[model samples]
Structure formats: structure tokens, C-alpha cells
Target: MYSRSNNGARSHRWTATLVMGQVLLWSCAAEAEKLPHNLQIHGFASQSWLMSSDNNVFGKSSSGSGSFDFRELGLNASMRPLPRLQFSAQMLSRWAGKGSEGNIRLDYGFIDYTVFSGETSQFGIRLGRMKNPLGFYNDTRDVPFTRPSILLPQSIYFDRTRKLALAADGVHLYGERRSEMGDISFQAGVARPLVRGDEAEAAVFGQLVQGHLAPEMSYIGRVNYELDGGRIRFAASATQLNMSYSPGEGSIHFVPVIFSAQYNAERWSLTSEYAFRNLQYKNFGAMPDMDISGESYYFQGVYRLTPEWEAIARYDVLYMDSNDRQGRKWAASGTGDGRHAHNRFAKDITVGLRWNITPEFMLRAEYHHVNGTGWLSTLDNPNPADMSQRWDLFSILGSFRF
Candidate 1:
């Protein structure tokens, strides 16, 4: 838990950083406008307000005035000095509940060199801090303009442990092939995963511990296929993330595999994804080694009322322990009181509206009817017994970009 004084200090720092970043981004954009087409710069800012009927999210959202503690700001630039080589980087500041403190940090920076290029195929390599191509959205989830709704399907995204999966320092090999049948692209990487924040530790152990989670060598890969120029698409991605706890806590390994599919039409689109997560914990103090498997999936549909307006609906589900979906076994084993059953699973129904007021500005509103608290952040809602089995969340956001 964080003290009120600490929260205040963090908020102040975030405000100062936001102002400085805005000024810098605008100045760079103004200068880039006069530069060659090889150089590009962009930035975005979003502010969100959320209110919940039960279980706090992104702050004390269940209370009066809800929470204005959610926001995101980002700036990025890319330069292609040569036809086959490019450099790109982004800086991001995000504030969300107690887990993220709105600190500005390097989101990604990388150098890309293409080894070969032809009319039908290309091969390349990238080295530096790069985003893990875990799913269709992980690479671009930070930008509000690219997200389908205010909040992504938590079942697969797991914002609680985002830092561990966000980006890594590594090298990636990529290739693409285009033919009359369709287009196929693949990317694979080996790197040291990022585990700086305490969020990943708290998520695995149920609370913040005395030790830290250290980064370890990991691997990630993805394969994507597009037919009829993206009218239909399919993707499969997986990653193995390794970490160790200091002071002799233990070793932890997380492996997750996802399958995704999407269909696009003139006015409507459909998307779905399924994920299986495997977690292993070994050599803990006196506790026996453990292995747990989790499952998640969601189906979503979007309809474009107009070029500037859209409507979205989705059903998302999550199970913390596939073997004990109802939590009867875990609850009976003395993990907690009977109320803990609801913590094992979650089912969410969501509806949202998006208004692209202009190419550079947008507004969004969404509502969620959720059952179970399986995905709630422990840092945000400390008292598990006080959590409600059913809850409601309403959110609104405004975003501007250049």
C-alpha cells in the first residue's frame, strides 16, 4: 500500500512531466514538418474518468466523484536514414491506480535493418528495446486511438502484470511473404524481460514481498496471416517469460499462448481471441512447488455507424485456475473465507461508443457489467472479503493527438 503523501508527490511529478513532454513534442513536430519525409513525429494525450459500483479500479472509483487518476501521454519519432534501415523510439507516461505511478519512461527504441527485399518477400532484424509481439494489441495498446474501447479485454491483456510483458531488450528476426493466396509474416525474438515495477511481484505472490523480481532471458514469437488484403486475418503468438526472486524466494516462469482471428467488412467487424497461461513456481521456502494453468477468451463485434462514429460490444471471460474454476477447492483448502470463491473467475459484458470528433481528437464512453473479481488488482482493492461478487463500471475518455 502507498501512503497519501507518496501519492501526492507522484501526482505532482506526473503533472510536471506532462507539461514538459507536451512542449517538447510540439516543438519537435513543428521542426519535423519542415524535414524530409523520412522523419516523422507524433504525440497523444488522454484523460479518463471512471466510476464503479463495487471494487475500486484505477483508484477509489467506487466512492464519490469516482477517480480521475487514469491518464496516458506519449510521444514517438521515427527516422529512416537509408532505404533499408530505420530508427524509432517512444516515451510514455501512464497513471493507473496504485500499480502505475505515472512515471515517464522509454517505451521502445530500436534499429531495424533489412537484409533482403524483393517484390514478393522481405527479411529484417531489429535490435534494442522492442515491444513483445504477444497479441494483436499488446504492441499498440498504449495509444487510445488504436484501442477498440476504453479498456481492453482484461482476460487476455491482464493489465495487472503489464510491465512484465510490455517490452524487452533483445534482437528480433522478421520476415514477410506476399503471394496471390495471401500474406504471411513472422517475428521471433530472444531477450531479457522487463521486471522493474513491483506490480508483477505482487501479482504472483498475492502481495508485495521483501525481495524483487529480477529479469531473466526469455523468448517470444508471432505468426500472422492476412487474406484478401486484411478482409480476413489470423494470428498466433506465444511467449515464455522467466523471472527470479532475490533473497532466495524462488524462480518463476510464465508461458502463455494466444490464437486470434478477425473478419472485416464495409460497416462491421468481428474479432476473437483465446489464451492459455501456464505458471510455475519452484523452490519457495517450505512451500511445495506449484504449477497453475489459466484460461481466457473473448468475442467482440464492432459496427461503424458512420466514418466518425462506432459502436462496440464484447463478452470476456477469465479463470484464474483452470482446474478450480469455481474456487471450491481452493477456498476449501483454507486460502480464505467463503467469499473468496468469487475471486477465482470473472465474466464481463461490455458496450461502448466511440466518436472520432476529428482526425486528431476523439471521445469514448463505455459500461461494464461484471461478475466475479478474478482480475481485480490486489493493490487497488486490498480487502478481498469486502469485494462484491457482481459489479458495474462506467468510464469516459477524451483524447487528442498530433
Candidate 2:
């Protein structure tokens, strides 16, 4: 169990860190004006309102008047004191229903040192907490301007498991080669995955456990190829994640592989990604050991109506267990009550429009027609039986950045 006093102290410390970081950034900026070094500061804030016809998301979206429980605020600073050395850090506070309570925390802080730099190629290493290069959007998922829509395709970027895939504390080695044909880059890291609170626990175990989940050493890597100055792109990423449960000697291991591709044209762009995940559980006293394989994919297209207006359409799908895509075997086994087959799979059709009012401000709205509850948050909708098999979600957001 977690103590309130301890939680409060942690929160205070995190807030203090953010404050101190901001102060340091200002100090660096002042000093940089006197020297040749460079310091850059950037930040963004966004608010969203969501309403659903028959489900809850980021609060009681289905309730009267809808919900305004979704918001994100972030600030970051980067300093280059030497030609081949750089330091960067970001502080973020995000609020999204019960899973995230808008706590201020260090998102990523790292020291990057270039081992070799030349006209056509470079090699470097980064130490400290850094974002995992899982997919194209995972590195910048929190930034609304970088996302294709209000919400990312849930099939690939499961918001419920965001914390788990966000960032890690360790070292990463990166290298890039450029030529007339295109550019090729790769990044690999060995770190400890961040597992906190009950969000990841519930997502993995289907419910919160009495024992705690402890992070273990893990590995992640990605490779990218781009042609025609990013008019076309391809990437492959993979991760081996491990965790342990205390007081009962339980363990978990999962491996996920993702493939991403995109094409950019003058007026339109197309994007797609596919992922395969294999999970294993062992040594739980009451739960039987098991292995599960899952699959997810999405196809998306965006068309620019004008210099400041855009439209998007996408179809996404998620299957929790590929072996039992319909979940007939698991539901028939009677593992628990309200275990419907539809809960194992989800299909979503989405459409949205984006309007850029100014260089630093924007607004967008989107609608989703979804079938199945596979990706719904268990926290917001505690009772599975109460969830509708088919539902609609409408959302609008406004964002500002500098």
C-alpha cells in the first residue's frame, strides 16, 4: 500500500524540480547572451473536451455536459556548451481522468556527446532518461501539433500503457549516415522501464494486484530509412520489457515489434503501422502461468485543404489475443464474470478536421465510431458489463505553443 504522506512528499519534490529547472534555464539563457554557447527554451499547453454517446474516456465523457479532465502542459530546455556536447531536459504535467492526476515530473533529462561528426555521417551517445524510439509518434506523442489527430490511433499507442512505453533511465547509442539516395539512422538502448501506480498493473493483469510491480532491466532499439528528404519513410522498432511482482514471487516478460511507414506528398500524406506483442506470466500463486500474443495495426490518411486547414481519416484495429481473435476460448473458460468475447477486439473508424489559426495556436475536432471495448480504460469504466459494444466519441481541443 502507498502512504499519503509519502505521495505528498514525492509530489512536492517533483514540483520543486520543475521550478528549479525553469530557473536554471533562465540563468543559462542570461549567461548564453554573454558567451558563444546557445540555450533554447520551449513549451506548450493544451486543453480538451470529450463527449461520448455510451462510454467514458478521460473522465465521465458520457455524463451530462461532457468532461474536461484532459489537459497537458510541458516545458523544456536545451543547452549546447560545446560543439559536440549538449544537455536537454523537459518537465511535464498531464491530467487525464483517474489514470493520470496532472503531477509535475521530469519527462526526460539527458547528456548527449557526439563521438564522431563529419560532413556525411555522425555517431553519438546519450546518457540519462530519454524517450524510447518505439514508433514514429511515441517520441513526441504529447505534443498536439505533432499528432495527426486529437487522439493517436489507440491500436498502436495504447493510452492505458503510455507510462510504460514513454521513457527510461539508461544510455543509448545513435548513429546516422546520409547520402544522395537517402538517410539511414539507428538507435539502441538498455535501460530500466518505468512502471508506476496501478495503470500498467491493471492493464497487464486485468486488475490491480496487492503486490507492487518493480522495473527490471530491458532493451529497446529502432532503425529508420528515409528517402527524398522525408517524402517517404520506413522504420522498425522492438523492445524487450521485464518486470517483477513482490511478496508472491511473480514475474512478467513481454516483447513487442513495430513496423512503421509513411509517405508525404504535396497535398496529402499516408501513414501505417503494424505491431506484434508477445507476453508471458509466471509464478503467480493464484493465477496460472500463461502466454499471450497480440496484434494491432492502423491505416491513416491526411489531406491539406488549405495552408492552415487539414482533414484526416483512419481505421484502427486491436486484438488482445491473436490465437482467440474473437475471445471465444477465454470467455467460454469462465475466468470471471462479464467477460464478453467482444472485449478482446476493437475496431475504430475516425474522422477529424484541424485548423491552424496562427503559428502558435490551433484548434481541432474529431469523432470516433468504435466497436468493442478492447482498448477502453478499466479505471474510467470499472464495470465491464456496463460498457457498450458500440459507441461514439466526439472531442475538441485547443493548443498553444512557443
C-alpha lDDT values of all predictions: 0.89, 0.88
Model 2, position 43: C-alpha lDDT score: 77
Best candidate, lDDT-wise? 1
TM-scores for every predicted model: 0.96, 0.92
lDDT of 2 by residue, 1-402 (tens): 321223455566457545655654565455546644487777777889999998799989999689998888788879999989999999888878767767777899999999999999999999999999998999999889999999999988988888888899999999999999999999998999888786787677666667789999999999999999999999999999999989878999989999999999999999999999999999997779989999999999999999999999999999999999877887888874657887888999999999999998999999999998899887777777678889999999999777
Question: For model 1, which pairs clash?
Answer: none
Stretches of candidate 1 off by over 4 Å are 1-5, 28-33, 336-339
State in Å the error of residue 15, model 2: 9.6
lDDT (0-100) at residue 159 of candidate 1?
Answer: 82
Candidate 2 Cα errors over 4 Å, as ranges: 1-37
TM-score computed on alpha carbons, candidate 1: 0.96
Q: At residue 115, what lDDT does model 1 achieve?
A: 99
lDDT of 2 at 235: 100
What lDDT is obtained when candidate 2 is compared to the true structure?
A: 0.88
